[model samples]
Each structure stands twice: as C-alpha cells, then as structure tokens.
Target chain A: MNFIAEIDVMPLKELLDPQGKAVAAGLKNLKLDAITDVRVGKHITLKLEAADKATATAQAELACQKLLTNRVIEYFTFEVKEA
Target chain B: MNFIAEIDVMPLKELLDPQGKAVAAGLKNLKLDAITDVRVGKHITLKLEAADKATATAQAELACQKLLTNRVIEYFTFEVKEA
Candidate 1:
C-alpha cells in the first residue's frame, strides 16, 4: 500500500524564530497590523510504500526523526492518509 | 475574535524542488529507501484578530498572496481555527 504523510516541522516554542520575527516585521511594514504572533515552520509531504497505514506511519515517524527534522531545534507532527 | 491560521506554502508541482530532492537523496544516503516523492514547503501559523472565522480566513488568504507566498513559483492553502 501507498500512503501520504502530511508533516509539519516547527521550531521549538522556546527557541526564538528569527524568520518568523522577520516576517512579522514585514507584516508591520505592509500595514497588516491585525496579524500578529506569526510562527514559521516547514510543511512536508511524503509518499511511502508500506504494508499498511500503521507501517507507513512508522516509516514517516522514522523519517521525521532521522532526516526531516533537526531534533535539537525543531519538532514535528504528521498524519498519514491514503495516497 | 482571535483565530489561528494553519497555512502551507508549496512549490508548484511543475517546478523542481531542489530542497525536496536533496532531502530525498539524504534519505537514500541514510538507507531509508521506502520513503520516496518527498516535497518540502513552509508551514505558517498566524494569530489574527478578526471579526469572525470568515474574516480571519480572508486575512490569511491575503497574507499568503502578498507575503507568505511567491505566487510565481509557489502556491498556498490555509485553514483558520479559533485560537
């Protein structure tokens, strides 16, 4: 079976997100003041061949731990769906 | 009302995703061959002060068009939930 993983990798909340700050500043410049507290992160979609949803989710988790995330500075979450 | 927008900015399917490719190659290097067709994108969470969910969604959409996304090379989608 083939599955698709929709993953989000985000900077740890305790860590300062420079990119998000920059974007917030940019919003201020744009006069979009109603928008605030912007947090930026990475969204990833992975296609995997596995025996079932459980297997695919495990693979996705392993991939997140090993390659898709920087465990020290970032954390991730994901959902698996049929491709 | 306060809302949270979960937004994703993705490279157009037609465009070659160098970052995705690099990650895929890295996965191969790590011997995770089960994972394939990896696509990388940005995930943004915006806190917005709006009149309602519809207003929040509109603001999030505008933000995507103006700043969160590079329309020429990328596209975006988002959902707004109460914060």
Candidate 2:
C-alpha cells in the first residue's frame, strides 16, 4: 500500500523562533498589522510504500526522529492518508 | 477573536524538488529504503486577530499570497481554526 504522511515540525513554543520573529517584524514593516504570533515550521510530505497505515506511520515517525527534525528544539505531528 | 492558521506551502508536484531529492538520496545512503518519494515544504502557524472565521481565513490567505509563498514555483493551502 502507498501512504502519504503530512508531517509538521515546529520549534517548541517555549523556544524563540528567530525566523518567525523576523517575519513578524517584516510584516509589521509592510503594514500588515492583523497578523501576529507567527511561528514557522516545516511541512514535509512523504510518500511511503508500506504494508499498512501502521507501518507507514511508524516509518514516518522514524524518519522524523532520525533525519527530519532536531529533537532537542523541535517537536512533530503528522497525518497519514492514502496517496 | 484569535484564530490559528495552519498553512502548508509546497513545490508544485510538477516542479522538481532538489531538497527532497537530496534528502531521499541521503536516506538511501542510510539504508532506509522503505521510505520514498519524499517532498519537503513549509508549515506555518499564524495567530490572527479577526472578527470571525471568515475574516481570519481572508487574512491568512492574504498573508500567504503576499509573504509566505513564492507563487512561481510553489503553491499553498491552509486550515483556520479558533484558538
């Protein structure tokens, strides 16, 4: 079976997101005032050939832990679906 | 009201994702062959002050258009929820 995993990796909220802060400041400069509290993260879409959804989920989680994220400063969540 | 917007920005499937290709090669080097067809993108969470969901969605869409994405090579989608 083929599955698609939509994974979100974000800096822990307690951590300062320099990118987000810079973007927020940039937007403010542009006079876009309605938006705030910006946090930037990675949206990774993985295509997995697995035996089942469980296996695909496990593979996605393993990828997240090993290659996709910096565990010390970031956390992740994902949704899996058929491709 | 405050609303949260979860935005996903990705390279159009028709476009080549060099980063994704590089990561896929690296994963293969690690002998993680079970995962394939990886696509990388951005996950942005924005907090917006709007009168209602409709307004929040509008603001988020505008931000995506103006700042968060490069429309020439990438495309985006988002979900907005009350926070």
Best by DockQ: 1
User: Which residue pairs does candidate 2 place in steric collision?
Assistant: none
Q: Compared with the true structure, what per-residue lDDT tens digits does model 2 show for residues B1-83?
A: 99999999999999999999987887777676778888888999999898899989988888899899999999999999999
For the second chain, the TM-scores of the candidates in order are 0.96, 0.95
Q: In terms of lDDT, which candidate is strongest? A: 1
Give a tens-digit lDDT track for model 2, residues A1-83. Answer: 88999999999989999999987887777667778889999998888898999988988888888898999999999999998
- At residue B77, candidate 2 shows an lDDT of 97
Ten-residue stretch with the least lDDT total in model 1 chain A: A27-36
Model 2 scores a TM of 0.96
Off by over 4 Å in 2: none
- Model 1 chain B: weakest 10-residue lDDT segment is B27-36
Candidate 1, residues A7-55: lDDT per residue as tens digits?
9999999999999999989888888877988999999998898888998
Model 1 segments more than 4 A misplaced: none
User: Per-candidate interface C-alpha RMSD?
Assistant: 0.9, 1.1
Shift of residue B47 alpha carbon in model 2, Å: 0.3
